[model samples]
Target: MNDVFITKAFTYLPNEPVSNDEMETYLGYINGAPSKAKAIILRNNKITTRYYALDKEGNPTHTNAQIAANAVKGLFDDKFRKEDMELLSVGTSSPDQIQPSHASMIHGELDMNKSLAINTASGLCNSGMNALNYGFLSVKAGVHKNAVCVGSERMSAWMTADKFNHEAENLALLEERPIIAFKREFLRWMLSDGAGAFLLEGQPREDEVSLKVEFIDFYSYAHEIEACMYAGTEKQEDGSLKSWADYPSDEWLKQSIFALKQDTKILDKYILVKGAESLRTSFDKHNLDPDTVDHVLAHVSSGYFKEGLKEEFANVGLDFPWEKWFYNLSEVGNIGAGSIFIALEQLMNSGRLKKGEKVLLCVPESGRFSYSCALLTVC
Candidate 1:
């Protein structure tokens, strides 16, 4: 088996950065009334600026595939060519079309010089690590000499006012809460539009340090918990979800089936607690010591979770210094699966890393309650 290394990391945040005050200008107000949830959610998230692939008039300026391809394009140069890549893996919670796979669309958007194995991993946040895991194992198994893994979300389109206007208008017809719950609505304020990609190969970069891939680990508590975040579905009274296909096409619009939803009750109850447990379990599984980590990069939805997660991790004796933590959420907002990759891009270029230092990567997904972790060594 060949060892894998991340030779390059790059990100594409579409358009210019939109400030907190400018968000409603792009996403607009649901039901023509300003969201009561937006200000409160923003206060907790601490996201001052974010990128959207949409214009101020709510028209999308870039497709999900286009942004993904753009991130991939940044990874190529004299050393690596489009025609040389053996695999292209893309992960996202949002895809432009439901018929063709996200990877297939991105492949078409890339318009590479030759055909390659294109894979799409789907989910909310964990999809990024899942995509990375696939490429890591493929290279480790010698199935490919190199692979490009991307995590992207073109979520502005889903957060638009028109998408949720039906639910706001038809609230009286539903068994669920008549008013859109904070859980059902806050994602419009939380998600951003962006794409980030990592280039993996059997050999490390010779000119500068590369991230030696050690391991990628993920855990899901779906059996004990129902979905915490979802789209294209509605939660039932029994905590089960009804698929979008089960409902009539018109009913889809009425219930906002395509709009993203979160069960805040479930999120508050399980996300941090399970994340700490998973982190400890994964650390033990890998036989790693927390003190060895020089930097910690994570996919965080809100600034609120940072201290909460620190407290939970402290409970397990994994309290690394707060200075060891680095997050770009305040600058870029949460890009879902792309969050970690964007964070990695900044860290990789920040000149903070020194040779032989270890970095820890973490991502927690509230959708179905999952956690992913990985270790990389600067070499």
Candidate 2:
């Protein structure tokens, strides 16, 4: 079996615009935190700006999957055809439905024949990495010459900014709905609608830049599953607000970190020193050391997480500057499975990847309470 390598990557950022400063003002009114507040707390304890999808009439527009599919098509040159793609897979958090899957929709849009295999996989933030693993294994097994993997979600479609922003309903159930306040705080940096696609080619030549998937070294602690969970959804009686949770952000953060450390430990045996540098630095109390890594890409939960992530990286001696990487959550917001894909696109566009270079891709999922990391090298 030969190695599988990513040949192309692209992203679809929604058309709507929402600024970080505007979100902070909204949060100030909601939490009464401070009149000057401008940062909305996001997944990784960060602040970010997000773009919303809206119709001409300002109704929430849900079209992230379409945007993602379109982005995938844009990656190819004139030489490739839909017929050339042997498989298509979607890794998304916000699915339009449980059956048929978003991949089927993308396949249809691409006009792929019925002979092509299509499927969907959900692993929260790990969706993209998991899909990559699947594609890597499949190509190595000679199942296909090429595979297309996409990570997309329209998280903004899950809630209406109008209803959630208002405080009238929340005043009545303040104590019982404590999570509502947290949700409102986090909503500002929540994932937005976007799609990220990666093209994986098999049977690569020696001259081509490619890296084989030796195997995924996943380490997970059994007790860490309860750290994060998806808050259930229900219809609002007055349609003023919806979506609530049961816990605070601190609890979620602690559990998430614990799981990440536990699971990442599996790599220690394979690359002892490098694994230590990655694990300790990423989990460091301060920042990641600049010298320990060549480049780093992380799931953008918020500005706070980015800062902490950068700090930890610096602490570990990785030489890259915090600003060298693209953190587009402020621009496109969180794109769930698409976040890493978006970062990869930015990295490629910058021409930063070179042969023999190593990059760290980290992802942490909220709903499934999972953390996954992929160590990729340019061949």
Cα-based TM-score, every candidate? 0.97, 0.70
lDDT, model 1, position 318: 89
Give me the displacement of residue 62 in model 2, in angstroms. Answer: 4.6
lDDT for model 1, on a 0 to 1 scale? Answer: 0.90
lDDT of 2 by residue, 1-379 (tens): 8777776777777664666555433323433343221232343444345655655344555565677678788767754566688878778766666566777777767765557776677756667667766776777788988888888876655444333433423543454432334433344455566788888786433554454333443333324332233433322344222233443544343222111111222222222233334355444433434354466677755554555555554555544676445565656666778888888777766666677766667666644245566656676
Per-residue alpha-carbon lDDT of candidate 1 for residues 238-355, written as tens digits (9 for 90 to 100): 9999999999998998878888999888888998999999999988898888999999987789998999998898898889899999989999999999999999988998888999
TM-score of 2: 0.70
lDDT of 1 at 366: 95
| Number of the top TM-score candidate | 1
Candidate maximizing lDDT:
1
